[model samples]
Target: MPWTVMPTFESYAQAREAFSWDLPDEFNPAVDFLRKHEDTSRTALRYETPDGGLETYSFDDLDDRSDRLAAALADFGVDAGDRVGVVVPQKPQNPITHLANWKLGAVSVPLTVLFGRDALQYRLADSEATAVVVDPDVRETVEEIRGECPALEHVIELGTTDAVSGEAHAFEDLLESYEPGIDVYDATPETPTAIMYTSGSTGPPKGVRHSHALWLGRAAAAYNYFDRGLEPGETTVWTPADWAWGAALGGTLFAAWHHGCTVVGWPRDGFDPEDAYDLMARHDVTKAFMPPTALRMLTAVDDPEAQYDLSLETFASAGEPLTSEVVDWVEETFADVAINEFYGQTELNLVVGNSSWYETRPGSMGKPLPGYEVRVLDPETREPLGRGEIGELAVTSDDRRVFFDEYWKLPEKTANKRTEDGWFLTGDLVERDDDGYLWFHSRTDDVILTSGYRVGPMEVEEAILHHSDAEQAGVVGVPDETRGEAIKAYVQPATDDYDPDTLREEIRDLVRDRLAEYEYPQHVAFVDELPTTTTGKIQRRSLRERE
Candidate 1:
């Protein structure tokens, strides 16, 4: 069965009228993908591990494994509407867990392997996950926090079981014991499929709940932004982002599967420019979407085009605003390839972007996609802002084509995101041009964007304050060449006798131990006091301006 609804628009006016979403009453992503693409022998995923091991999973292999896993999970008492936390590296098992969860109507909460015990505990506690799937590397962290999560009943270890303890079950053993051919659950389009967590300014990360139809909504992006009307099974998509992020989950994994394209998943301890270049050449990637930081690093390599045989025809970037220099470098390096920039939050993926059908404006996030109603609104009045005036970017809440269901377990925060009338306010600040292009502005909140990761300033500040030598700390994002924004910290010492060099290392170590590695401040400046308001609240904007 061919896809009944594929967005193919010649112009913006045609896109507005032609784009319509129609999901069946009972929809499962695994069922939908397998049904649409009848060729079960075609490769669905081509994964490369850090140790130079290559693995390929065809559609049939995926279906069988996921069915077995679903059956095994059901035997373990996992039910519909239950949350299953997945903490694993980028591999075939990660996507298997996701499909298995959808097959059983369970919500999969993908947690980054980079997260520490405290960070992991918060999400597990908040989501009340019934079971968690972990790789052997993260098994110890899960075991340490297993006691704190009362709702957690099972810990399924992936890869090796020797390190597992405390009522843990081996993932391989469960799959071997369970029978295949488990029935896929009938889920409504509105049923929650995944609860992806994203960092905010003031509190812990908020879980962005996405419906089962979220995969269908991503087709608008895959067709327009990534592959540009490429035929099914013709394009190969690749990204450096982990499965935990929307870039990899929605953009690379779901989008490719939805379109019947091969997805390349590479797992690495850390990003290396040489490894990235080698993977693209080795995999014959036809289309790729990467963060601005990764793109910049790849462009910085000497004779990048000469170094490898890049098969990329369409390249898209997100996570942060792309600089004009990088844009120029991309054009020069990958001659004749269309390089587009996209803008969207974790809640709603790819709302506004430069599509293949549209003209690329250097430094401007292109017009809103077909199904979304995007606009710039005044932060205070909730009124639409005119072109050239900076305001909060918003999307009409009535349009469910590309919108999040809600923030999981945070009704108050979810309510705060929307206006009384209808618009869902995105905390990002942007301005629009008369031509409908959106221009990037600073974030209204204090969350820092460094190398494609959203780093909460409060989290880093709290970690800095944990150091005995630190009295008070204010964090801000400053312009960076490689990393879209580099985190900078202004620290006030508790005593004048403390050494700045020593305190900096201590502060970095504290954050590295407590939070994700990408969140630690890259630059630390010792100061007597930080700029503050009359109420004693630190003025982060002022600190940003000073930088």
Candidate 2:
């Protein structure tokens, strides 16, 4: 369907002017956000370590440490627009480094600590990153492959360690050596604040850049959506600040700071639901954003009824499509608290979501937020589709003020996908309902075409998962001359059903009963596990690799 809402301020003409919310000339995200809340004496960050120790940082404390770190990074020749690869787990140090880079007007390239040397080297070379902030445990991997990564100039370890190479510097020592204060970079809305690398299953990773305005818009929307009333004093704890998942960490950091609120973080490796619950209860976290997987794990915990009050005003889930079943469970467990789900990607920030003011639909990702336009379009012709028609999802840039400029140094690649018809084709397909809520289907690459019908694997899998015996499922298409391609399902059973043939037939029968006959899997394989990427996205390409 066509976008029902018209742009109030976002237009082609508005693009010439800045899209940012105006602040003082000296304003930088790091200082303006932190210093604005420094005196509140509220816990800015509630942290936990891999070894299960908890720590806290107030806004004032975080500001000081970040400033010192920014100054230290400057000493290592980090400058404006310089790319820095940071591979820290979910800790306060992640945002500290991120904000410090923002203060320096440098592009922060945050990498997941779980990645090995090859992944690290690829990102470093692709981004031409200047320095790396890595965990002490993972430093050896980078060190072993440093010779392969020529663009990487410096290494800063997060914890104190004696395994320093000639090129490595201690993170604590770097912070201690810097003087008290340094000048923060004054970035315009045009300045690129951060470059997030997409986990390209189809190809090499591509860097998606965001301006200060884009990041802040998402944050402000989140705050306003929750009615959190973050008035320069309150704090919010969000866990797992992996750079790939920037919407939760990056968006929360900016949004909390926009209202002068504190941003709390959880421990790196110890991401237990119990620890997260305790940290929130102890620190009194008022706002939070977690992945759907974490939420699922949270529901599985014991004595959730008697656990901490969980007095949070707003709780959200992003990155992956959250199922209605998960949402219902959260609402039931948490006194019907609004478990808001937002939809967006690395290429575009939070584009659509359920807000506090609006009544949320159970399965809907909500409507398009202010300052953006979204539509469902035919994948081939790029023609706008009517409501209830299933097609490719796209967003327009006529309201260009907030849109990304281009993929850095990858012009052909950017143009090949992001189009000039004002539509940036999001590879995912969707079907807009009569009420204007968008229902997410599989990615265009994941949609299985069989017998002249487009079958979304999510639909089939959701039906299959409804069966109690099914624990996990992955669906792909295998070549079939008669039908073009037929649906093939890979399942991991919840029970010890050693007889694959019986379980497979039962699953096929279950699918046939629940879903359309054409949508039922013609073949079922009971495997120990389905191949997945580092971030847990099932690699359908790998399935296609099989016969």
Candidate 2, 1-547: lDDT as tens digits = 1011111334323522433334233345676567754364666666666666878787777777888888988988999999887777667777788889988999888776656554566677888888888877678877887877788888888755465655688887777778657888888667777777664324455777777656655664565445544555545645443534566655676566656666665545435778767777766677777666567667767666477866576677665567787778877777646778877766776777775656778878777665567889888888889999999888764345355666778888778767666677778889998877888876777767564344567666766787777888888878764455688998878888557777777777766654445668998887778898999867777987887
TM-score of 2: 0.76
Q: Which residue segments of model 2 deviate by more than 4 Å?
A: 1-27, 38-41, 161-166, 224-231, 240-244, 268-271, 397-401, 446-547
For candidate 1, the per-residue lDDT at 138 reads 80
Each candidate's root-mean-square deviation in Å?
1.9, 10.6
lDDT digits (tens) for residues 1-547 of candidate 1: 1244475567877986666665566678878765568687899888877677888888888888899999989988999999999998788888899899999999999998988777889899889999999987788888888889999999888853565566789888778888789878888778789988888888778888988777777765767787364456777888888888887787768888887778888888877888888888998888888888888888758876688898878788888898888778878777767888888888876788886676788898888887778789888888888989999999762347457889987888888987887777889999999988999898889888888889888888887888888889999999888898898999999999987788888888778777878888889999989999999888998998886
Model 1 TM-score is: 0.96
Error of 2 at 134 (Å): 1.0
* lDDT for predicted candidate 2 compared with the true structure: 0.69
